[model samples]
Target: MVILFNKPFGVLSQFTPEAGHKALDEFGFPAGVYAAGRLDHDSEGALLLTDNGPLIKKLLDPKFGHPRTYLAQVEGQITEEAIKKLSSGVEIKGYRTKPCIAEMATEPENLWPRTPPVRFRANIPTSWVRLTLTEGKNRQVRHMTAAVGFPTLRLIRTKIGNIPLEGLQPGQWRFVQEKVI
Candidate 1:
């Protein structure tokens, strides 16, 4: 079985516990499943979980090129040129990123507010962007946008591969049957 979860901000991606934080128990998952890829404790949104090891590998492996989409709220005004650069590729921490989709999103309607909301600065305007990456690198979206000069203020994953966080709220989950491609 495959599960698509809308992980809330500040939640660990693992079933394991960390000090001063909650675990999968707090999110309410049935025993025996594990996360396919991690979303940082500070970041939020769509995370996949399963008991099937091979399916997990195929989804998490970079070679499979499964697209994971995020809605990133960035600090400062972003230019169209910068969006193009992100779509093309950007060198972050010495390695270049694979080409990905980056576009401005209309203020995300019906987005559930994050617990302990992202920091806001009176001086800097924030823009919402939709970013899709096939590779699951450590903190990649945060690093990529920062490298491009518009630092990400908040990040949310809305979709993973063909599954979306539709109808799910933070800390909620639903069981889905695997789609045979």
Candidate 2:
């Protein structure tokens, strides 16, 4: 069985708890299913779980280049130059990212309010960016935005490949068709 889960902020991707953090077990996913990929504890959005080992390999392998789409709220107004830099790839932590689609995005309608909330700054402005990346790196989005002079204040994965984080609130999950994979 394949499951598409809407992971919430502050939740760990694994089933086992760690460092006092809430893990995927809290969601009550079925037995034998394991996460195909992970979202960070501080990040939120679509995560896939499955019992099929080969499916996990297909999703996590970098060469397969499964696209993961994210919506990031970054500090400062994002600029065209920054978008170009993101689209063309940027050096971060001694490695350069692969070029991917990066564009300005309006805040999504019907967005759920994050618990604890993103901090607000009176003097600084924030803007949204839509990024679709084929590679998954540790804190890559946050690192990329900071490298481009726009630090990410909030991050959410809106889609994984063709499956979207739609019709589900944080902590909600549903079985998905394997054909979509």
Candidate 3:
């Protein structure tokens, strides 16, 4: 079985709770299902879970070049130049990211309010960028945006491959057809 979970902020990707952080166990995922990949504790959005080990390998393997798309709210009014730079790729933690899609995006129409909310600054403005990456790296989206001068204030994975979050609210999970993988 395949599952799609809309992970909430402050939740760990693992089933085990750690250091006071809530984990997947709190969400009541079924036995035998495990996360195909991880979303960071502070990041929120679509996380794929499955019972099929081969499917997990296929989805997590970088060689497949499966796309994962994120919506990032970053500091400042992001410039076209920065968007272009992000699209072309940037070096983060000594590794140059693979070229990916990056473009200015309006806030998602169905966005739910974040718990505790993102910090607001009276003077500095912020903008949203839609970034699609074929490679998953540790904190890659946050690092990439910061490398180009705009630090990410909020990040949410909106899609993985062709499967979208599709209006799933935070902490919600649903069984998805395996073919969507």
Candidate 4:
């Protein structure tokens, strides 16, 4: 089964039990289904889960370079120079990232309220940006934004390849056709 899940903030990507965090198993996906790619507990957005081994491999293989798009709300007003720096790429954990797309974006219109909410600083303004990357790295978006002088206040994934976070609310999942994707 191919499942598109809208993972909520503070939820673990996997089904394993953890203290003070919700896991995928709690949502009752079919047994043997596993996350093709993971989103950290602090991030929210589109996550793919499937039981097919070959399908998972195809999605995750770096050579395939499946693009994932994220909408990040960053601290301070995002500058053109920062967008250029992001597009050119940034080094994380000592490894340089591949060149990808980044642009200033308006706050997403239908965003759900985060539980507990992102931190607010009255004196510090925030801006939204759309970032697309083909490689999945540990906290890559957070690291990239901070490297460019705008620390991310909130992160959300909006799309993965052809599938998007459409129609699903936080913690909701729906089965999809694997072949169509």
Question: Top model by lDDT, which number?
Answer: 2
Between candidates 1 and 3, the lDDT winner: 3
- Per-prediction CA RMSD (Å): 1.4, 0.9, 0.9, 1.3
At residue 160, what lDDT does model 1 achieve? 84
Q: How far does residue 57 in candidate 3 sit from its true spot (Å)?
A: 1.1
Specify the poorest-scoring 10-residue window by lDDT in model 3. 172-181
Ten contiguous residues minimizing lDDT sum, candidate 1: 172-181
lDDT by residue (tens digit), candidate 3, 1-181: 8999999999999999999999999888889999999999999999999999999999888898898999999999999999999999999999999999999999988899998799999999999999999999989999999999999999999998888898799999888864755
Candidate 3: clashing pairs of residues: none
Residue 116 deviation, candidate 1, in Å?
0.8
Off by over 4 Å in 4: 178-181
User: So what's the TM-score on candidate 4?
Assistant: 0.96
lDDT of 1 by residue, 38-60 (tens): 89988888888888899888877
Q: Candidate 4 — what's its lDDT?
A: 0.91
Q: How many residue pairs clash in each candidate?
A: 0, 0, 0, 0
Q: Residues 97-158, candidate 4, lDDT per residue (tens digit)?
A: 99989999999778899997989999999999999999988999999999999999899999
Q: What TM-scores do the predictions have?
A: 0.95, 0.98, 0.97, 0.96
Reference-based lDDT, each prediction? 0.85, 0.94, 0.93, 0.91
